[model samples]
Target: MTRLSHSKHNSLDEKDYIETLSQKRNTSKSRKVLEVKSAALAAAKQHGLNPWSKDSLILYMCCFTSFLCSCANGYDSSVMTAINIMPFYQTRFTSGVVGSTTGIIFSVYTIGGLTSPWIAGPITDRFGRRRGMLIGAIVICIGSAVISSSNTKGQFISGRFILGFGVSILTCAAPSYIVEVSPPQWRGRMTGLYNCGYFGGSIPAAAITLGTQKIKSDLSWRLPLIFQCVPAFVVICIVWFMPESPRWLLANKHDEEAHAFITRYHGGGDPSHPVVELEWHDFKEGIATDGADKRWYDYSELYKTTSSRWRFLMVVFMSIFGQFSGNGLGYFNTQIYAAVGYSNYKQFVLNLCSSIVSCIGALCGVAVADRLPRRTVLIAGTFASAVFLAINGALSARWASMPSDAKNLSVGQGAVAAYFLFNIVYSFAYTPLQAVYPVECLQTNARAKGMAMYGVIVNVFGFINQFAGPIALKNIQYNYVFIFVGWDCIETIIWYFFAVETMGKTLEELDEVFTSSYPPRAQIRKVVAIKDDGHVDLVKEA
Candidate 1:
């Protein structure tokens, strides 16, 4: 009996000791995290740029020029809608059923988007980010030149395809570069600047087209097509002068350069600084987790774990639904306005005004994206967009049924007004968050590939939206707008339940958010950590 009692006592003692050891181990981890953060704060105070620093503002300015790569995409998509109205363009190209031809021309860029990602992902991963962007810029310039000179439909379409190809690659390189390089606090806002760049280029696309419309030569249409080269050319010259992404530098074995880069740009020129160590540790952790070599055959790694798989799915859905959300209507607003008798110069003027409105909305999104729940902003944007689209569809259908004379009344104009409203809402809500969220969802090694995958998914729906819009206008008329309403309702539900919030996370920290076992519907997430700086770094919280 004494022996049995002694055995029980020994077992209980061992259990308690194990528990005590576990606590110590956990305590050690927490201590290390605090130490690193505290050290980083000290270093930032001594050497690094804070969120509101002037040096940080200069960096943002340089980055915006690089981001002008996306501006090419925005300009190209909308330019055709305006150019299609050119008598010279129509005289040379298809005159009858312009919608079908226009849709094909506009959507061919999506085809380029689809194919180029397979190339861009591997190239960017291998050659480095700066080189990848340079290649894209060169191609964009070449494609723009081609479009400007072409007189045949076949040549015209080829130029567009080439533009899409380069722009697709640019889209891949720019976002990942921006997310990787920018400070955690301003990432969303800077990313939100995509709309500003996009519409900034677009306003000119209309203004130039509208200005040249009175000119009596091919120069009227050709000048705008050639103008596409100017932004891309500017990007080429400016981006080469800027520093490469430090994350890419580190990943590609340029550790010394990476260290210096983070210090000079991110840490304010203190290599031994805590900000350097903190950001450095994140990449080290990412490299450790991404232990597998990034080979072409290793695409399976994207789904090797539950975290990656879910992340991949989230990115894919965001890309696909981004188009089908009826936001594509913004690209075709000139044609949409024409349905209400506001074609020609009036459409161009309105487009410029609305592009400015979208810029304002995008600014609003930038302001809030970092501050608010990502899912909430997305839901609000999508829901508000659906309301406007439904109203437009209803009004357009009623006008279509009335006598031809009635089509010019307030109700017809109301449909046009509704589309204009959708433009404002969609630009503000979807433009900034869409690209920002998907890029945040992906793993480091998989980001380029993930974006490549994004290119594929987004272009597929882009083609459908561009192709179907004009065809539906020709066949089903204004009622076609209803498709977006129903589709958006379904998307809103999926987004509310499934989307991960990624507002404040450093890109490296996001690996943990998607990997956590927490259900999506949980309202109050456990506080992960609050830095000494009090900057919110919540992964799921964002």
Candidate 2:
């Protein structure tokens, strides 16, 4: 009996010891979790910037200057859409506006774009973002003068070529500068806003053309052409006053300047602020003093590493997908409307109304840019665009062939509605992301060259779209719409399989994501603060 009682007591003691050990382990884990949560909350608070603050206002002003680049591009496109429908323009050109000649005139601009990236990449890297923008704007002003005064088709095409080249340089420099300088939390909205300026220029161009269309003179087209220079001129005036990108400063060894810039804009003049410290740390760790941006001819940096290749892949995908997704038809919206029994005057009205609706959609996109995941917005938007395009195609096929008097009024209106809906969905998905996604994907080292590469691809595909769209529209009519329907669906699948989620990370933190074997599948490791020393570390959650 004594032995039995002793054994039972020993077993009870062992069980108590095991239970105590388990309780201690649980306590340790709980403490660690609490520490992580506390640190994350602190970091969140540090990044919660006030938009109404003086520093934020200054940052916004700088970003707005960069946005003019997009506005310039939009104005030219919208103006051409309106001018193509004018009787004076057709009489002056004397080369039918419905066929291959129209295609050549439209495509010459993008051809000029194709020639720009080589010079733009090197100039932007060597001189600085501000100077690159200034040079491009100056060139645009000259191009505008030439085109507005042109008396011949060759002169008009040459002027447009110059305009394209200048716009390419502005596009590359402006987006890079905006991304590098914007606060990480506001990067999406600001960069997205940069592209939204497209609609800003478009709305005015449409309105001006609508007013000018009734004039029985070449000034109808010339006035709108001259207006293209306005946005670029605005950029040239304000960009000199804006601060240089912090990343550019850091990359060029202007450490003190970069630090001061960050402290003022990101930290509200507090050198010791957590946001300042974090930015400083990221710049120190991520930027290389002797990276590819420093070398004028080193294009290999974009493809030399697994991570960089993936980054460029995303750039390429976006460039091709963005241009091909039925928005290319935008430059010829009048023709699309004319096919459905609309008169020239009615076509101008529809074009103006469509531009306004598209602008609203782009603004809505800017609002949710940071709120939603990029992949979610892109996938949903592309799929929705496909559906609308298909609907438009079906309606156009049914009603476009009928005589105006015999056509079903409801069906014609439905087709127009479908076109309007398509613009809204396309603008919502693509306008905001056009510049934001490519800039976000590129690392500092590869940014300039990668953007140049992106420019080349965009223009190349843009050339195809502009040159071929008119021919295809004339030959296949509504069948061309089905092509995009199929292409957009394919693009949706590609985005689903390949697109990386870049919603919440800083430019530097993306390194971990890209460096992984497969970027799309890579998890964003949490950035945690070490309790012992105030340093941050990337920790994967269990």
Candidate 3:
């Protein structure tokens, strides 16, 4: 036996050491990860993750960058809501053309998101999470510049498409980077932080634009759109200093590097310790034994392998639910307000208030995510969101029928209150859940690819709903659209019953759940099951 020296005055006494050692042995034997990498590979791994154990400030900073990326995504998606209130769009296009124009703008961004899963997955696999982030920031900055300079709708839409492309790329890369770098105990909170920043970004998108509501110049909307470059610039400047995913290095056959990262990440300590070595061993063996070029992760394998299949279903369902449950409404909220007899300035204020409340909700959600089981929080939040939508839908329907009397001012106030309530619930529920859900559900091998597919689904539905909003608000009542989507709230029930908790569990533990018997209710109930295979079946009983 080799006697090792450790830092004195440590928490890990003799009993802790022996117990940790036993736990490591059991986990490694079960996980089947014990492998090696070349000398350079080992050195590269050591340089990055070596100084911090558990949670590093750098890890949090990296998460904050991810938060900014998500904020950019949220801000751009909703910035147009304020633009819709502007005379620029209204005077330029007819009522019939307005919906189509907005849809085109919304749809083009989705195209950018669609391209990233295919493009980003390979690069992140080959390069690293930090490089992927750096590239995304550069792309986002250029896109913001183009959008700011656009005089015509064509140029404007083109810039939006480019921005979407960058957002889509980060969607897959950021959370994947966070999960790999985060301690298991704190992963949920760290991941939730991105969503906090996401909605926080919405504040300036709404409030700043609303604050400039009095600005009659074309620069009003452009100012908000261009501000996106500020965060992009900041993220690009700081991201270079952030650590690359140690797991990513090990996956590329850099084990010694991985150990070095582990040492620095946890502070200088015995590298041979079970917990430290186990992560390295697992990363190496998992990549090597995967029996494919780690660079090209096949989506088809996501459904073929039991672990991958489970992740695929979770990502698919969550994405669908994310879009269906009024996320699109948030995108076009100003339009919804305009249709309800509010003036343009008032509509801007309403959107600002909603964003403000949502920002607060996102912060609270971050606090809650790691404390409870991931599924429980998701289930509760989804259910509460459904209830909020139901209330909002019912109020809108009644408001449509009510006569235009001064007495109805109270009802208008109530509608505004309900709308903000919906935003609050949505931020606490779907917003963070969408980010963390994919991270929690997928393992490292197919994680990026799976999230991209999820992003694709979300935008597909998003494009449809965005197109539908202006048309519905222009033709039918806003109430009808809310009612229609209020029904989609049932997906929450499916999620509550089917989605597994992955809060503190390891990837290997999560993998086992999908292999064991438990088909989501939709499959059992004969609802649509979109599978590559013709038939849908439950997992085998354990």
Best by TM-score: 2
TM-scores of the candidates are: 0.86, 0.91, 0.82
User: Residue 462: error of model 2 in Å?
Assistant: 0.8
The whole-model lDDT of each prediction reads 0.72, 0.83, 0.65
Q: In candidate 1, what residue range of length 10 has the lowest lDDT sum?
A: 1-10
Candidate 3 differs from the real structure by a C-alpha RMSD in angstroms, to one decimal, of 10.2
Model 1's TM-score against the true structure? 0.86
Better by lDDT, candidate 3 or 2? 2
lDDT for model 3, please.
Answer: 0.65
Cα-based lDDT at residue 359, candidate 1:
72
Q: How well is each residue in 260-368 modelled by candidate 1, as lDDT tens digits? A: 7777777666554445655775665464323322565466647899988988888887887778888777667776777776757888887777677777777777777
Model 2 superposed RMSD (Cα): 9.8
Q: How many backbone clashes does candidate 3 have?
A: 16
List model 3 lDDT by residue over 113-196, tens digit each. 776667777666667788877788888999999988887778877898888888777777888888777755456787888767
Candidate 1 pairs with clashing backbones: 501-542, 502-542, 503-542
lDDT of 2: 0.83
